[model samples]
Target: MSTTPLPLSALAAPIERGTAAYRRANFALFLAGCSTFSLLYCVQPLLPEFARDFGLAPAVSSLALSLTTAALALAIFIAGALSQQVSRRRLMFASMALAAACNLLAAIAPDWTSLLLARTIEGAMLGGVPAVAMAYLAEEMDPRHLSGAMGLYVAGTAFGGMMGRVGMGVLVEIGSWRSAMAAIGAFGLIAAIGFAALLPPSRRFAPRRGFVARHHLDAWRAHLAHPGLLRLFAIGFVLTSVFVALFNYVGFRLAGAPYDLGPAGISLIFLAYVFGMFSSPFGGRLADRFGGRAPLIGGIAIMTAGAVVTLAAWLPLIVLGICLITIGFFVAHSVASAWVGRLARADKGHASSLYLLFYYFGSSVTGVIGGWAWQHGGWSGEVALTASLALAGIVLAIRIEDPRQPDRSDA
Candidate 1:
């Protein structure tokens, strides 16, 4: 019941894993992850509907998600740097409020252009959350508890991803995609309030107020120059690209031909994210019990095998394959992200931002490229592309060494 604090030189102590304070911190972050992902991804299942309503190609329809992620990728770098000058909690709160408001604007936008503009701005606002969340956890959580805490946050993402996709699908069937967006925006508003209320003050982080760009640049350069961190960043990129590409186009594949699944049916596929939710924490525990190296390799191998299984035409096999892919991706992501936090001895915010910058970049580029592949070579082509990327991830992950020491509690 009592919190344990571990000292780290000049820095304040970290919140340990199994305590009331730690539980509350994790709960608040869980809601933050839930709101963030739910708002960002609610439109995924509606891509086919966007195509029908907007009179667009499959590749263009994917712009709905790709554009948002693209903007998010760019904005995170600036937000990460800004966290050094501003209160990190305030930055995240403002981001959640602004993004939820933009989602409302997007829900009511009368035209496709207007909708895209709203979503783009929303993506920029969302940039404040993900990178900052990782950095915050790394700074405030005890190193012994860091992996599981990160896993819990990632699980929240899985829950949100599943809810957002599945919720929109069901809502669209009941009403329209517009109504679905409105509902998700309303949910985000409530979530933001809960996050603001429940999250505790930062114990380990102190705001550094200055307009020095050189300090920020130097931090980024340090992370980039680290061989292990560089490889992890590459792995993040490939992993996300492969995952996003699959989900972006899989709707088109199942909606036509033998599967002929409707919007609600396609939504069912996102239930695979439940498997992801479980795998994240499970993978974190495995890494803690064993080591990051074997779990990382195993996850990538599972992803590769899952991609191959999905090549089959059978619907049952396809669903099973999707489950495998979902579990594998989340496990790998949870491990890789935790490693990034541990590897960075300083400027963890910058390190987290760099990792996510590449991650979302993969989502932006590969999502669109996968669409093109779907347009030309169909599902088979997309599969080949993603499988190759997953393979590349395996090789990159293999090159990363386990950390020589546990994370230090310093900013």
Candidate 2:
């Protein structure tokens, strides 16, 4: 069932953004991105519904997602290692298809525990895509144009996240959360088929055909010891913690108070990801021209300001603040993600996996902790925690110097 890879020299040219090869690569990966994220986060808007139907606390309901992310974080480590023995394209397609099926199972589960179990397994199945995507791009694309491709891939994730949140919000108006989950699972199935059909075979990769733990361990150790890579990993943890925590509790905040937004109205808030779609590429371009440090710091600053602004009472102002935070998160993430490939001298798959491990770990930990803050201190408490995380990210960004660039600080 395996096709022999062509010589590396023949396929090593990085796909430029406008060429036909680039078009095919981006379209397939974009769909893959959309499917992966939509399935993963589709449960977010349904947290309140779970609380009402299952009589779970906010912190308990948060487990539905936290379990998925926590499992995904650990699974990514294993998946990244497994990918060395499996074809990248096959691994991603299988991941998407399996995760979609898991979503459908969750939709039909009769009890709360069953649904959580489904989500946890879904998270583990979904790990193959993100763990290997950046590595695929790092190996396949022209190194000079890598930022643009990564930006586009990230943009797809934003769109997928928006669809998951907004679509669930809108779909629930017609049916229950179960129906929403079923519908999104169907969409994921379709995207998975398209991804398998459109993606070209890997020319640069040769499957290792078996497990090799020592190699992965060495790479992980080397990356952890490198100061620049270490800082980037820390930044991933901090920024994602802030982003997920804000969105996790914001649903509860908007649903309860003077705003009293319904699910659909709360769903509209995720439309802020539209800003994220644009900011991802824009951040990547900035990184290409200037450096990762400036955009990274600027994004952290914007995220912090947005958190502070959300403390305001006005709904319009709060929405604006969310949009700013969304934009900042995507911008910072785009830079940091692409930087991983550039920074890793070798074992790019292991490097990319480590970055996402921290990223999702942040989501799982802060996401639940923020719910606790909500239970104890309300919106103000959530804002305080997010703001602090953002500030820490900024400080880390300031202190770390990019090895690829000179010591000068100009952005």
Candidate 3:
């Protein structure tokens, strides 16, 4: 932890304005991001199997997935704040490695309760990566390349998320659910080692002298003072809650009514996430060209429309709706996340963690509530819940006026 402050030019110089090393580093971090998210979400497709094997209801079985995300949301703030004391590279590497081990433990668990405990631990360990990765890029990457690098990292996350959902589904079809989980965990372990090998030593990170409650409070105060930051935080909560709720209950709906899809078929629905990979990068560039506000608002609108389309019983329309939803989610997420880096004056790590804490908190809370909707109101109920959340997001986006013009800091 270097106590001395270095010039901004020196800290941000490692990734030159436009250089190959910068590009390579960005790509490496993208892969690292993918691996981290894939490991975190791999259990999504296995929810039904857990219910059958454990003799639980839809909401109870969902606890397996929801608990991990809940733990992750809580731990992210701790991890980000702690990074001020520890080395970023060492913390990220350890987080991935330990999370992988926890997944392995989950694969071998004898009962549902044991598996849930393992996943909770894994989620806590996994929090270190996302909470700190954005800050690392902000500190090291050139300002011009920041959005691109962030977009690439997000692309990796989209891909990893798709792979985790689709891969688990495919693997479970051929083998037991435990085998699928173990395989995904092994892949994560390998990716973790690769990430450790490829990520260059941090050249820009400087450790704070010590953690103080005042510093944390000041960071929060600074963030809350910024209108854009508050809007982004609200959007994070609403967008993620809506997205998670849709995905969480889609399988249940598809498995029950007209579709009667099996676990493998249900897993295939995650294929829609492939659209997110492209949309994320495209959204970033669009934001770079046309300001972040328009695309951010437009993306949410598109997602809202998609949620409406999903109400149809026609499978094709539902698939198209999912694709639109996926595209909208990644675009909004990429812009909003990159925006957080721009808005925070200091302690970017803490800001990023706060953003993700709201993001995952939405997933954990709304995801379980979605099950109740699915049970009672059927697909219509699910649609109503998600659409309402998306509508709230749109209203929030509308409220976020352009901050380009000078305004009082304390509004």
Tens-place lDDT digits, model 3, residues 360-398: 878767877988888899888988988888888888877
Output the lDDT of residue 387, model 2: 91
Please list all clashing residue pairs in model 3, or write none if there are none: none
lDDT of 1: 0.85
Task: Give a tens-digit lDDT track for model 2, residues 64-84.
Answer: 887897788888888877887
Candidate that would win on lDDT: 2
Candidate 3: where are CA atoms >4 Å away?
1-10, 14-18, 52-60, 110-113, 372-377, 401-411
**Model 1: per-residue Cα lDDT at residue 198:** 77
Compared with the true structure, model 2 gives a TM-score of 0.90
Instruction: Give Cα-based local distance difference scores for all models.
Output: 0.85, 0.86, 0.81
**What lDDT score goes with residue 217 in model 3?**
74
Colliding residue pairs in candidate 2: 14-141, 14-142
User: Where in model 1 is the C-alpha error above 4 Å?
Assistant: 1-8, 48-62, 372-378, 404-411
Count of clashing residue pairs in every prediction: 0, 2, 0
